[model samples]
Target: MTSATETETETETATDAASRPAPPLIYDGHCHVASTDFIPRQFMEDVAATVHRALEAQGAAPPLARLVDAYAAQHQDHDADALVAEMDAAGVARSVLMVPDFSLRMDCPLTPEEMARRHHEIRLRHPGRFWVFIGADPRHGADGIAAFEHAVTQYGFEGLKLYPPCGYSPSDERLFPYYEICAERGLPVFVHTGPTVRSLDYEPAHPMLIDRAAREFPGVEFILGHGAVTYFDVCADLALHRPNVHLDLGGFAGAALPDGWPTHLNRAFRLGLNHKMIFGTDWPLNRMTGGLTRLVREVTEGTEVFAGVRRREQALILSGNLARLLTRKGNE
Candidate 1:
């Protein structure tokens, strides 16, 4: 019944609304931008050569440099700006950057001070785009805690990152002081809880150890990174029981969901644990586009297949829920 001009005007308005940027609401709760430096040209070349030598051992083609070059072209050597560009393209608004395991390097050693300094610089350059998690090596004893305290006080770090079993186990009494400090200061603790490629004192990176910490320190917020990938059910059980415990869907979110994985996600949803589930891509290792797409698809499919879920619930899992949790209380 509308005139042609009126209809055209309405269409233009709708187009403009659609073109507006999607809510700047995404937060990559776990990532490792600092680890890019570890992937130097020499290291890549060494890995490539090793791959080629192994292949040649089996009478296969020797394409080491070619493969290395391809990966190198896709991602440069320790270029954070390029990472930022990739995040912008993929609609990620912010990333919580964590330091890599220091023990891996025999040379170019990274003490806690050095790690904190780099994080401060990165935060200064990127502002709100990058949030830092101070890395504390329990092996350093008192010195590590002092360094961690400095980072938290000076850099305004939001959380602490621990790679237990990388240098020590979560159950070790030596690390309890650090956990106490975090709890007292009301800072969140993010612990690696999955299969780690690097050599560590412990293997499998089980969530059970972390569960003990959760029970011990109910005040400190604990995030089980990778959603305790190999321990999703255990993580779900923890989330159900512990109000302060949360799960970070970092690298695991990008991978295709297994046959029973959706059930765990649905169980968390049913238990009203949506806000505790955060979105993270573990970028550079997994492209933001691929991670976001997989999350969107899985959440959408889960809602469709499950009885007590809706598409809006999927939106909560992707971004809305995280936005609420990450923001300080009363900000919402």
Candidate 2:
């Protein structure tokens, strides 16, 4: 294979259509602070090897320090100070932190409660720069609901992070109570819509189920995470037809790299879903610095595929849209 293309640094201030700087302040709408302890062992080894291979393919010997930093970043729960420091470097003003439900999939030491507690502590310490999405395995039943309520009422978590791959489904009757709580509290529910590796129940993480929840709870807002991964058309349909449903582009850009997820996002733009789309980096899995660049514009030239989208619309997707949701929810 030919050499991998060189990735451009983000110093260039001009774009193809206009001579403007990148958005001054971005809000990373989705992020995960789960430590390396959360990742399954074999997967860690696989990731390390993949990085080594990529470096080798580029005709450079992978430095041990590079591998060390890669492993360290993913292996440790992010520190609030460090996260904010990265934000300063990336020009990100705010970020939405998310915890994952590893109860069924990994041998994680921290229970959902402990994880949420840690995340809450960070949000409190960091204040305005960080918000949180509470995650749960509703399969834990009544106990899970109680913990969720406590997180919302006691700690003031702003959103719900549902991991259907953790032995549950978005359309399950058990989730209705949780969805109802979100509706009542003016919090949006974030559903993992699309395939997820490292879990047994990936098949049930569907966009259709999320759409059903959006339909059933019209008062509640549902944001499909990962842009429905491989279910772009379905996500676009739901976001277009259902005012309460939206999508966040988190892990998709990194997962699809190079050309990025243009076809899928371009479809959303063509259908006028800009206001419904939120920018996210799925941090650690993808870093805020470079990952965000590929998603918003061409790495080398800063050309965006959704050329017809106005600057204000792009700005909204970067931060304004999610800020609007947070504001509206606050008044509700």
Candidate 3:
């Protein structure tokens, strides 16, 4: 019963819709839930203690317990509603939520399985808005391994996040089993590759510690989190030489020096490793400095961190590279 003119119009509209290019991807490669439930109480206490000692040294002392309470108060957004609103404002299409297992190393209420379930629930609540990277310390033994495998096989978690500062080398034999799962599943591995709070063991997180794993597990992609701001040259070198190794700009959220971030990033780009660079803001951790909008602007607009980067390359740094990594091999 449709008119010929109406049919023609509809056909034209469909063609136009199909022909239009997809929107550019703006992805946040790293972030976390700003909730105390996910972060361990012991970790909070350590952070509070570290800050207190630092302040006392500088002679700007505040009561220790008060500071601890303040730190606790900063993490109220359990559901990430505020984070989603901010991401929308910043034009971030998706984010990777990193849930590191602190149950073993710290006094945490939630076990590894419970934490993984919480992240899976968050992913379901938001659908395509978030991807999850789960962490399971090798010290958790068989139970931890089972929980990690379950998250990937049943819950559809995307990647693995390892915190070496929790006291284990990236090259540890215990982590090999996890690496095998990542290789088989085509999941990337993100390792904490630099200094953290004074509480954790810093020596274990040295950049070179990942070299052995990078050489051994060529099938799995290894991303050095906080690579930009910590051991920049060494991390860039690893990404430059190793086919499977890459770097994420997680700690650049608070680049204070005028030329600090740009200089370090340009060095990597100059080494022809632009594609190896993934844009990440350790959100909520750096939320005190600025919002996601500011972080996005610093990398995408004007003559700043991404000044000389072409549109195509900029696309890779912003989201294309991550999109490629996130694609499961079998699906492709």
lDDT of each: 0.66, 0.73, 0.84
| Clash count, predicted structure 2 | 1
Which parts of model 3 are misplaced by more than 4 Å? 1-24, 49-60, 255-258, 330-332
Q: Which pairs clash in the backbone of model 2?
A: 36-75
**Candidate 3 residue lDDT tens string, 1-332:** 99999999999999999998665579989899888989987787887898799799999979999988888898888888878988998899899999987665788877778888888888778878998899979888887788889999888889999999999998998899999999999999999988777668899999899999999999999999988668888998898899998889887856554677767676666667888988888888766667888777766664766667677987898888888898957412
Candidate 1 wrong stretches, greater than 4 Å: 1-24, 38-79, 104-109, 201-204, 253-272, 288-316, 319-332
Best by TM-score: 3
- Per-model TM-score versus the true fold: 0.76, 0.80, 0.88
lDDT of 1 at 98: 73
Query: What lDDT tens digits, residue by residue, belong to model 1 across residues 1-332?
Result: 89999999999999999997555356677776534344345544554565577688999855777867765665542536766766676667777887644543333335557767876877677766887777766778787788788888887777788877565666567778888878767677888887653334445367777767787888777888877345778887887788878888776544456655556556556766666777676766555246444553454444532358554665666677555554543212
Query: Which 10 consecutive residues of model 2 have the lowest summed lDDT?
Result: 5-14
lDDT tens per residue, model 2, 1-332: 33333223222322443565555458888887646644555445545666677788888857745775667665565455655766776678888987767676667666778887888778778878887888877688899999999998998888888877766778888889999898898888888877665434767787887767777999888888986345778887888899998888877665654456665555456667788888887776655346444443441134544567787887777788888877666721
